[model samples]
Target: MATCKSSSRTGLDSWQSRKSLSECLRHSLENKMFTDVTFKVGREQKCVQAHRLIVSIRSGVFEAMFYGPLAEQDEVVIPEVEHDIFEQFLRYLYTDDVTMDGASVMGLLYVSKKYDVKTLEQKCLAYLSSSMTPDNACVILEQAHVFDEQELKEKALSFILENGYGALKSSGVTDLCHECLVKIIQAEELEVDEQAVFEAVVAWSESACRKQNKDVTDENRRQVIGEVIKHVRFPLLDQKYFAKNVVPTNLLTDAEKVKILTHWICPNENVSPFNANKRTGIIRQEKIIIQRLAGLCGFGCSCSSGADHGIMFSVNQNASLQGFQLYGPYDRPTAHYDARAFITDPTTDDVIEGSSVTKSVSVAAGTTTYDVEFPRPLKLSKDKKYNLLVNINGPKSLYGKSDRSTVQDGSFVCSFFNCQKSKHSNKLNRYTDVDEGQIPGLMFLV
Candidate 1:
């Protein structure tokens, strides 16, 4: 009875064999083994050789070039693509793998598109999407426009909109072509203040003038910017700021400045040529009232100066924390208070960056809720504990309701914990499950 022992190494051997096959193909391409065709690539006219069969099987363009009416020519001239980029494109056809980075990704993308390699094109797009940041957003947007990649263009545009100030301030924006610049500035949902947009455009204009060998004068800047400057909503700029800063630039003629200033005084009159419609940056979606109290819960809940007061909670769904609603003083007229608000991580005892906002808040008459919005919405993840606190000057009366362990608003399930309070320390170290909490509700964009 010769019993054969089944070996577990069979699967490992098969995997190794498949990997070796890929490596062998890659080696053949790299060594230019049995090459039948040559390509004169790049402006320098570098001659590169490759196997026709492998490329023809991988790319429709190559297949057509080798077997179609153009099959007579054994040598292909690719004057537009760089030699290294062309080599990488051939390597992908052979090995189905490519090494991409910031510098080489765009070149590879161009080659992929020219060769009609759908898989490689998708990989390039994915790389662009994942590596996209404010500094490179404008560059990506310009390249996306050049390649006519609608999805990549939209993704880059959306990223710019969300981080408009950062993206526009990036030095890469100065190199954008006229069409790409116009497309960005003309977007209605661009989430940047008109003043910032004006400054950025002016900077871009100067750069454009320098590039064109023109003097960096107001006239030359304006000429370079051309229609792109028309998108700057001058009416949205503060009248005082515009008069002091914009008027000095001489970018706008006296008549244009007067029209904008006059439109500010008489808003009903549509005198300005630029679009006065406000840019819808981030839309507020939902306001979740954590504890619904009919009237002010004046159960000795007062927030004094240099004291942190709010609730610690976690949401079951993802949402952007736009702002928080605090209770105004009881039976008090419209009052203003200098306050500092914060969203902190309870577990790490660290405040979320860009989540702290110091502003003069106006609390309306009676026991109403005052909404204190953050500079920008802070994205909140699911199942993460966060503390929302506000430290206001003086011992102002606050409002809240009985302890609520959980609140269900629409599809969001927010579970509340003890109200966190810190008197002197920067960290929120004290916790109290009191009857009334200062933070009554949270505003979110789901």
Candidate 2:
């Protein structure tokens, strides 16, 4: 009976076979073994040697070109594509891999598109999409549009929307089509302020004017600015800022400018509403702070504390609240540990209904920084102090510390402890001691 070495021996044999196959294929490509077709490409018309059977198996276009009526010819002229690109396409067919840089990726993408190599085309698209930046996004967008690459187009558009300020500053923004410019201007999430957005539109209109060889008349410029200006949040501009900056631009009609100015004087008048665009005002990104409490309360307790603990901060601007950050009871997770939050109008001391958001503690054995998410974005009002109350449950599991040295001026945290230890057996303990102090390390995202 013959004894088998092991299953590992079979695996090794398979690996060795694959390695040998790759080496043989590479060797064939290097030495032009069994060469069947010669491609004349590049400006200088250089010849690249390749095997018809290998390329035909990899690409449908190559299969037809190699086996069809043209198969009788030993050479093909591919003067439209560069020699390096043609060689790369051939290399991909033989080795199933391509090495491309940002500059060369676009060329390969075109070659892949022309040669009907779907896998290589997708790889090129992925590379271009990931490599997009402020400088190249507009150009990539135009190329994607021309090539009908819908996914790449969408990614480019999204990148423009998110980073429009930086992208618009790039000279390439002026080269975008009018429709692309419209989409960029209409994007509600564009991080630029309204004034910067208006200025970008002006610059784009100037480019449009130059390209069309038209005078920058009020009518022509207005036509160029056209419906795009309607998306600008003109109402958000200061009336004086509008007079000083926007009025002199001459992009607006005399009547239209008067309407905006008069609307500022009397919002209820016949003039167009400041929010004519019906825009949900741009919400600025700001970290609302409740200055940390001056002293660390030696207070450590279980999550079961009936009274909730959190800082109070006045949101000076109307904001879309994402969530709140909590500096938790440090050192380890405890079972039955749950933390919840509630919102209140501090002026009336009334709890706002439907603002309770909760989360269970995913405990680690050490101090944890918890980013407690709100159930939904809380629409906060301007100049109103809102109390964020954190109610916790569990025993000796949650603790809080206060850092007083970092005094942020805008907010304060309420301190509470079990002041009255219940005398009666039936009653639970109460946190009635109010030590209003600066509470740091707590923040809510706007």
Candidate 3:
């Protein structure tokens, strides 16, 4: 229809470049193979520059060459483009619809941003949000936040905060959640009362905060506190695993606290222990509680239900954390118990059980492992050192061949430990680990 700004009225500063560029493009396109190309605009006089603008192909797209002529909404042109982005752009120009895969669209997001192509930027943001892993989501969220794509930043922020300490406490994301919470609070410049806070934080159930559960559960209690602590989260990427065995849930015993600290310190698919929360803030802190918990713990009492949003909790022995975590290979030490050994806390150079405890277990490939898991509810304190040790008795004791080989011991004592007796009456125990294709003997302490 009509254009946003007439080039003649905007001044003739670009006249020289526009003239030369259009002439060069017309010269280049004259000999190209084109049967039926739309070239002329009815009302507009067929100027030399206008003809070049319509025929010139950039990154394989006719639209890139003659962008936003109808309005100011789409005038910017991106220069740094790969041949493939050009191809994709051309396809979009011809079809007006685009199918973007992860690898293909990542570069386009930068390109879109560079060109100020708001529509394309939004599309790429959606694509990135769907394709990202939790770890990658965290990284992307930070970048989106920095770029000030308000909508995209909000989406990424919600995904990053989707889960809280309580739901993942025993589920292995405690530390990660704690870290994200702390960062959000600090970024908002909120004040936290450290002494008023304690380690035993009890946030709400994950499903309780879900939108689908909104009509089912009265979240007024969570809502009032949410205003103060800002605990809303986006469940977009988090729900991907909701239906898979990767996210196991026992509704019958869902109320138990978690020993999820080691999860944050464990490696993820990208390798290296996931310090996802560290990317946001410190783990197991009150600021984390206030932000993620919505001051739920501080509203009334640590144990008060429906009144306290995720706020400060009464400090207790239940010390656990949660967040986006990475867990991969474990160190092969000796396995002590025939059952799986889990280390609640992950620390390096910490002596197990205050002694030089040495243990290793041989693993049976596809059958066994001394992998650690949470069998009980636990909460963690902030910046406190806690040791989660796994003891192995001898070869062939603890092992895992398939990751599904995980077993939970209900004694609430799945951890392997060494209780060194007095030198006069006892002997130091040494355990050995044998490789059987199972996960190696590993100890993770948070």
Candidate 4:
């Protein structure tokens, strides 16, 4: 006797099979096909009818409530969970998917934990981690601390460290718990300078002190900062800043203030550097060339009307030419296409033989500032006038507004029409008439 081949072994695999089955079950859920239990949730007491077997299989709390001891009851109440969250939770049980925003994740995570649903709990944690921002990291850290989620808390803390200045400036930082604030200010690695860190701490303490209805005096603020003050690297602050801005403040004692000022001005004459408490970011330079915009150019598409615009600047030292910034609207599929950057000599009006950063474009919503970096740094010479030239094939893709009235004002800005080759004639290339006063946006850093 012949047997049919196993559908599980091929296109009809377990994943697809489960997806189709889940889709059918989800449709059934909407129609209330086999729902046998009703859940009355929130203060409004909204009613949600769901299949008992589906809920029992997906959740331990529901399984025990509907099968173990209270099998006879057909109606269940969940006043602790809001109706929107509960509905999404039930929808997940039937469809195997959950949609949530930052605000709702907390409540859903709580309900998921109460129901002993590990999958939803993990998803909630991941979402919270991804959603962390400079403005929200402090508040998210507080919530993570309350939930006892070590991983989420660490991620939030890292975000605050990376965006230390912004995080500290956020209004939410004032509402952050004392321990959370301490953890942030005490971090051993912050991307911002020590002075910015100190300012942020002082701001946060002032806000927190006011929130507690405490006076904003120096001694009060010192007490508010607590152990966090020890982490501030005062010696890293500018000497003048220390004398003018920090010394006048009553936050530090005379001796403590003297110690830091002395350490900065006369390091060997005083006590040793505060190495143990000092937090510093690892030294690394991005070596990116930041280009400021002169004017946006919007050329209409025509096969015969090819034009290119560029900005000219002189390099002061022997260095590598890397990349430049471009600003344009993100409207077309051509936005994904790679543009070109080339360098040329201002005196000779010839393309620098090997000076080109190729394939430097990164695709994004092209409407904002796009930093195009070269595959490798192209070498340049000191005292040499170089033009950072760019060309985009598509029309109206590269353009900016200009308010300058005369061609003489836009001297550094140049343009060429029908000059396809890098070695195009000097006669064909002339100072662009659009806006000379417009600051050249093209900047290159070695």
Judging by TM-score against the true structure, name the best candidate: 1
Clashes of each: 0, 12, 74, 11
Ranking by TM-score: 1, 4, 2, 3
What 10-residue stretch in candidate 3 is worst by lDDT? Answer: 292-301
lDDT of 2 by residue, 1-446 (tens): 11112123355454245666657666667666667677889888898777778888988888888797756467778788898888888888888878998778878988899989999999999888889886688878877987899899999988876555557766778788877777777777665567667777788888888889998766687788777877776866767888888888887777778887677777766654234443232465555544343444455554455555555555545554556654455444534457666676666666664466788865555543456655434556765666666666654443334433234334422222222222211123232123432123444444
lDDT tens per residue, model 4, 75-148 = 77789999999988888888878889977898889889989999999999888888877667888888889889
How much lDDT does candidate 3 score? 0.33
Give the best candidate by lDDT: 1
- Reference-based lDDT, residue 365, model 4: 55
In terms of TM-score, how similar is model 4 to the real structure?
Answer: 0.53
What shift in Å separates residue 16 of candidate 1 from its native position after superposition?
13
Record all residue pairs in model 1 with backbone atoms less than 3 Å apart, i.e. clashing: none
Count of clashes in candidate 4: 11
Q: Clashes in candidate 2: how many?
A: 12
Model 2: CA > 4 A from native: 1-49, 69-83, 128-142, 206-226, 238-249, 269-281, 284-445
Model 1, TM vs. native = 0.60
State each model's CA lDDT, in order.
Answer: 0.76, 0.65, 0.33, 0.64
Candidate 3 on 258-336: residue-level lDDT in tens? Answer: 2122232342323111122231322333212211111111111111111111101122223333211111223333222
Comparison by TM-score, 2 against 4, better one: 4
